[model samples]
Target: MSEGASFRTYFEVEGEDRSRLGAQVGEQRRRVAARLAEIRNVVAVMSGKGGVGKSYLTAALALGLARRLTRGVGVVDADLKSPTVARLLGAAGPLALSPEGVRPALGNENIRVISTDFLLADGRPLRWREPEHERFVWRGALEAGVLREFLADVAWGPLELLVIDLPPGADGVADVAELAPSLKGAVSVTLPTDESYQSVRRAMASAQDAGIRLLGVIENMSGYRCPSCGSTEPLFPGSAGSRLAEDFGVPLLAQVPFSAGAVEVPSGLLDRFLETLA
Candidate 1:
């Protein structure tokens, strides 16, 4: 009878499809690892949620680290949708292509940088041609593929360190750690607020679970300083970042005051980073 027909699951029906997908992913993974192997160390700067100046912190750390090493630093702006590292560090492109791979742009301190923004011109946004519902269904997978491509194809050369400016949450951290075999540790950025605290705490846990050690915490926009008078006032007043570092058994690396000078990386910052990440 027609009612007696056996049912089959999608996995059973599409076993070959799954194998093909796995092989594709594994190929990309191998490329990424081979590329990253040239870099001496890999670290990620991440935030649990956005609007914590995480991108700025990433650029600052890279610049700081570059000064400490002659080999220089590299950055992969993994925020495929809204990348700021390129603009933040003045890595304008149309990137170059070499026999090795796609060469990353040179930012300040000659920071080797790769970002989607460098591919798009004149502040154009990256959007899928698909409809909203279709984008929702496949955007995550698409973004992951884009990230793997960036990691694998960029000609970073040999670097003292590579800092990844991850988009908010654990997904970016996990992906970078997986792609870059020698990933050392990750720094969490947060504001002093309950929302930031809750999200960043979970993010740090996710990073640790992903096999990347929690190196330290950065409390950005901690206070506002008058550019002219040099007086500091409370901005987002709380102990969220300090408490997070304490709870995670990591150091609160710095309390960055919001000011015109804030864009300038403090010289002592690298000392602190080396002490902690060392």
Candidate 2:
């Protein structure tokens, strides 16, 4: 077989077949090295629980950093099971694949996105049997050298920052700690509620155990401004984000208020976030 064909066949296998494992490992390393050369910073956006607006924050940060960062920005939807970045960006559909890769990332403005949602047929559910099932999928992709090719060979041009939108809870955090060691730090997102704050604290500790730096915390759904009375109401109450940041020696970067408009991704807010980074 030709070199190109041989490389293609390496990843086109099923299950944990350890036959060509050595070759796969070497290829993965090379891919990781190439990806590291181009992408300067990798930051994971994580939350301890669901309904805390983690995905929205990831989109905001990516769009924000993309506008400010010199090289460019990309968002990797590491939340494989519930990938929604593509839909939020209005790029949900069949994606074109090339010899360059399997599925191409959809681009908007300066941001490029990759997600499992792009792989599935319309409305297909990613129902993994066990909790380890998703992790196994991720591991298989990484081991088969698909992830390296996805990250390194993809046409992500000149990225200064790569934002990873992780799955909710500690599983995603554990995966990042194990596989993607090049991540600069993690940006934890949480609501103003005490329960949400406590969950975020646990996540922080998990990341710390993995030796990942806590870049900062972002409080979402924080306060709503009453247009009539000109007063701010605490939507969820308690300033737990501030307390956690102080306790962990990390910055409480921003407290984003809930907007009453249609729940489309806020390009204006993203622009403002970029400006702040600038």
lDDT of 2 by residue, 1-278 (tens): 66666444645765666686787766766666666567777778898888888887887676566556667778777777678876665455465666744444655654777777877667787644346655965655553343445466666666788787887886566565455567778888889888988898998888888888788888888888676785768788898779888978977778777766533344354543343333
lDDT of 1 by residue, 15-45 (tens): 4674577888778888888988888888889
Give the candidate number with the greatest TM-score.
Answer: 1
True-structure Cα RMSD, model 2:
8.9
TM-score per candidate: 0.88, 0.76
lDDT, candidates in the order shown? 0.84, 0.71
Candidate 2 positional error at 58, Å: 0.8
* Candidate number achieving the greatest lDDT relative to the actual structure: 1
